[model samples]
Target: MRQAPSERGIDPHLHRDITELIEGLEFEHQEQERATAEVSWYKEHTLFFSLV
Candidate 1:
């Protein structure tokens, strides 16, 4: 019987899968950067105030 997609076997779908993985990682990185920038902006604009 033939093995089903062994680790040593060549897959025709590998290229598409790798491309998708890379794109997903890049998208996540962009989102992280945007979140970090927003947090930094909020921190910079914050001021300490005391009320009596």
Candidate 2:
């Protein structure tokens, strides 16, 4: 059986996995920001229209 790395070095598989996870998290963060901005805009418009 092949043993996995057990020392302080870059493993290709691990590096790839971590990179993918970071990218996924960044994409999710951007989506969340967009949704938040949309909601904020809607709320502001709704409030302004209600007062008019």
Best by TM-score: 2
TM-scores of the models, in the given order?
A: 0.51, 0.58
Model 2 spans with C-alpha error above 4 angstroms: 1-8, 40-52
The lDDT for every candidate, in the order shown, is: 0.66, 0.66
RMSD of each: 12.3, 11.2
Q: How close is candidate 2 to the true structure, as a TM-score?
A: 0.58
**Candidate 1 lDDT score at position 30:** 66
In model 2, the worst 10-residue window by lDDT is: 43-52
* Candidate 2 lDDT, 1-52, residue by residue in tens: 7656675578889899999999977976666666668765543224221121
| CA error at residue 6 for candidate 2, angstroms | 9.1
